[model samples]
Target: MINISLKLAILAAGESVSLFYKEQLEYFFGDAVAITAYSIENGSVFSPKNEDVYLVTTVSFECNEDILKYIPKDKHIIIGDVTFKNSTINRLKEFPINTKALLVNSSPKMASETITLLYKKGVNNIQFFPYYPNSMETYSDIDIAITPGETRYIPNQITNILDIQNRVLDRNTLIEIATTIGCDYLLDTKRFTTYFDEISNGGIGIETLIEKNSILRQQISTITKSEGIGVIEFDVNEKIQSCNNLALNLLDEDRSNLLFKVVQNIVLKEGVQSSKKTKNIFQTIYKNKKEEQINLLFIPIIKNDNVAYTYCLIRKNKDMKRENEIEKEYLKRGHYSRYTFSDIITEDTRLIKTKEMAKKMAKMNAAILITGESGTGKELFAHSIHNASERRELPFVALNCAALNESILESELFGYEEGAFTGAKKGGKIGLFEIAHNGTIFLDEIEGMSQTLQLKLLRVLQEKEIIRVGGDKLISIDVRVIAATNENILSLVKEKKFRIDLYYRLNALPINILPLRERIGDLEILINYFKKNLDLNFIFTEKAKKLMFQYNWPGNIRELKNCMEYFCCLNERIIETTMLPEYIKENIDLKEDKNQSTDFLLILEILNILKKSEKNEKGIGRSYILKCLKETNFEISEAIIRRLLQDMNKKGYIISTVGRGGSKITQLGKEMANNK
Candidate 1:
């Protein structure tokens, strides 16, 4: 048997158990074949010891895929780590060759959810191990309840168990388990009893215990207050137990005034109306008693002698906010009111030609269709076309079809009257078309709009007017329409998913933006443009530039922008070819290509011929070579090719070299080749 040891990790309520697990796993694994067990519920780590006993303070959900995400996925193991994401349950049995058995366990709720999600994801071959603390028959679905030093009594639930044997654990069951149990096991019976005993008595004693809880509350309060985040705590009775100042600040009142008042009036008075909501909220704090810093935790505290008093904690991590802020800053830079034509950038002569045509169509008040791949800047071009036309002075409205559903899109595009729906604005609202009445409206991702909405839009395009969602008023519109889609409209039309008449009306002055690969000539220009605007200084090496030109650019301009931004953040200086991702670097051949390179080299070889033929006028051809040199950025070998052709001309051979500054073909040399 493969040697395996297990370790148990425990922590006080509100402490992160993962830190201890992480430290221990790193020490034990050390880039070895060792399996590290992590409790995702409590964020704690577990490692195998020589003794084979695993101790846990609390029983939390564990899964194999989670272990793989942290370590290597292609390994064999008996016990699995737990994960909240439902996608991982199916692949557990197929881990490795040495994997003899797979153990799957879950809390009551997680069991159902995991099985359902897994079944939906097409996962089979899971052996169920339902954890019951008071069970001893070792059923196929029953595993020994996680307790300290109980490995000998525990059955190999994956292989030999009765109730949970040879059955596939699905995603729904895993989700149910992960949510209910969290990651850590609670072992302190005394603490559980103490909490339950105090809450069961149900005495409405107003004790000044805020000062006692203040120290514990301050830990989360100080961080949230300095960062402008919300933090609050509740007890088993769903009463406001404690909260940081920031939590009350977000509520626009203090803890003693607004926090307590809201809890007493709404949540507490309601008496846990939603069990699903309350269970999910309460389980995190109940399961992971060790976890202190929760990201948006909604904890529920249950108080009674039978069950321990529970605490609900909800938190949003500060790191995610910081990352979002950075992305928002970038998005803000390229956006203006309705994002008009000024945002599109292009130096391609063909695209410029297309732009001229698009602008003409825009000026004529015709419906225009823009089509291209996802990141090819279709919306930017649409905005630019609108701004360049006479509608520049008027409002330019842009709508995202994919962002809202049918009902919402209808309300957004066509004005809705007050009381149109349950939460409609009181006075009523102006539609996007109305906002751009005398100007232009751009619809982006039009393929995502429902067929019902498309039919309505076709009417708007053909009629030049619209009716409010609830009102019968036919509002006349002088709006120009520009629609863009990454999807193929013809395919959608063929599929009967989109209206053919709408496509025909919108197809007037259709513009197809060439993807980045087709216009490789513009790569250098775009790279330089991005580099100039970025906060850091980054240069591309010649090899790196060559790799850039070779990339297929699946994500188009957006990918390039993201890649350049990442490079800027990662390095201050040059981006070398080796530094690029593997796929980009693979096709790049820095070495010479015989046919193409030699032919180009022949042009530069001309310089030697000129030197031999026109010894006295050798420097005469230098200026001609200089022009070619400048074009090739002074790759001297190419200049020599032109010189060779000039020399051949003087020698009565078929060659071309002229110009007082350099080399060209003589009439006699041309005649010689013609005669031959």
Candidate 2:
């Protein structure tokens, strides 16, 4: 109520000019500062009633004793690096290439400044000559004239005019102002950190660095915004500065009632004494109006090398415990790349070369397109490339493009703000892109992304920024995208199914993984690796290997893994061609007693399925085998099973019970069945 905000007064040559600069300051600083303007040419008077103030005036306004006596004199800064509207650039672009134009402003200094800014903004196509009121020089050859909302200064002879509207202070000018007013701490806030990047045509001189508490404060903001925690900041004198939504709820007080209120008088418990301004954490327990216990973690922090602020993170007791457990569980399953180039177990010359090339591409920052059949380990290569890159230490987020529908996938990839959609999370969610900042995002099945999503993704690739699903804020991210697709993207593009621009954007660096069949050299090595990894004791006989090599593994490495798993399940030591899966044996000639092997497998399958009968010492009858074989799809009859049993009996693998008495597996047959 004391009006303690900072103040800045402006003195321009005319009333309109003075109000113009004052408007810029008001629009930027908002209520953070109080602004006033007086025109020197109009002989207007500026009387200061408040002792706390700052003055911004040209030498033309002679300083009266009353003004200096009222406010203290500080250092002076000449504002220069001002920025204009981006629409200004767009309007200038409409002019013919290399067209000559005149830039008219209120004064010669302002005119030259505007022209210089235009050139810096890459509007070199248009030649601009500086013009102002009462200038001795004139440009008759220039038919086009541009003004920064100072059209009155333009000569009437110029019919074609482009008004850039008005110029405003750029980031650098605001930084200087904030620093001058001892409000530089605001620059580290989320508002100023993303201030220039958010606004339209917000000029250069972005904040180069942050103070000591910037990162810690950012961490605080992130933690505070999370589901469980609620953060509140207060000044050294116990005056509340800020409180989050959860905090307001937990305190059972509205924000308007809590902010700027003293803790001891209104809300704080007797045990919660005024904390001294130092680096310390104060833990306390309090019962809210709902009769539920809440935990408070008060941390005193020094900002700008001064003990002016402290933070209190509050959470309900039960929620805090649950949140801790969830956090621990999250730590167990983290976002990390599990594979590197060394993990790619490949002996094929082509695959080896592909890995080497991919490793080379990893050092640079660009979008990568991996084309291969499904299960070819495109994600493996993606992980390896990220680990080999400079951003290896950061997160590695993998999302399947085909798994989610359009809206869900968009929300997951780019996140959404609170109240963005129905059932949106309270604080919204941090997207995979934000989580993968300064790292890599492996988008599996990129071709499966809808056309609309592809266009949005193209914008991200071009601008290195993303607007959340239902948010206007532009979040700048430094993520390296590694997109993979099993489909023929070029074909899809030609068919108008996929966007060509997005394809080209993603295909900046391309890697095509050969399917397992084309690189059969790696088959044996991969088999061994999968066997060892799966802890399988089976040995692939040369016949089985031949059959496997003959097969075209359309499913690629993942299919090969499945094949190994199948052998593991069979629990067979001698994996002959007949033991191979039916799919693998397709179109292959097993010529060597293929019938005998088949019969052998049938008997094994019968014995394994039925095992030893309970009431009888012998096994189930041959008719049962015939029944199972027929049920499972085979044209064989009971006579075939009888002959197979007789041959097996000759080998002493089973007790010969050809009559009504069922035949049982002998010890030798059991040994083979058990894979001994």
- Kindly list the per-residue Cα lDDT of model 1 for residues 1-676, writing each as its tens digit: 5342332222211123334444433342333223233455544432332322222221232122222233322322222222222223323434333322312233333333333333222233342232323443345433223211223334545334222222221122222222223211221233322332322212111111111111122122233333434555554445565666655433344556644433643432343323224443322211122333333334332322121222223343434443354235324433234554445567876666566556545544556788999899887787778777656755677889999989999998887888888889897777777767667788999989898898898778656789888888787766778899999887797688886556656764467888888787878788877878786565554446766887889889999898887787676454555567655656554444565444434433343334345445433455555555567555555445455554454454433434454454444433332222
Per-candidate local distance difference test: 0.50, 0.69
lDDT of 2 by residue, 1-676 (tens): 4353566666554577668877766665667777777665565534543423444332222222232333344434232235665666776777778788888987755564456556545565676667887988778788888887889888989998877776655554566576666666566666665655433342211111212233234334445546766878777777788889998888777788778888753336322343453354466777888888887766665556665566777878765453454344334548779999998998876777678668867865657889999898999999999999867877888999999999999998998889999999997766777777667889999988999999888777767799887789887767789999989986797698997556656775668898888888888889889888999776554457777888888889999999899988987887877678887766564456767567656867765644545246556787776777788787797788788788778877777664688777776676557762
Each prediction's total of clashing residue pairs, residues at least 3 apart in sequence or on different chains, is: 90, 0
Model 1 lDDT, residue 569, Cα: 64
**Which model scores highest in lDDT?**
2
Every model's Cα RMSD, please? 29.0, 23.0
* TM-score for each model: 0.38, 0.44
Which prediction has the highest TM-score against the true structure?
Answer: 2
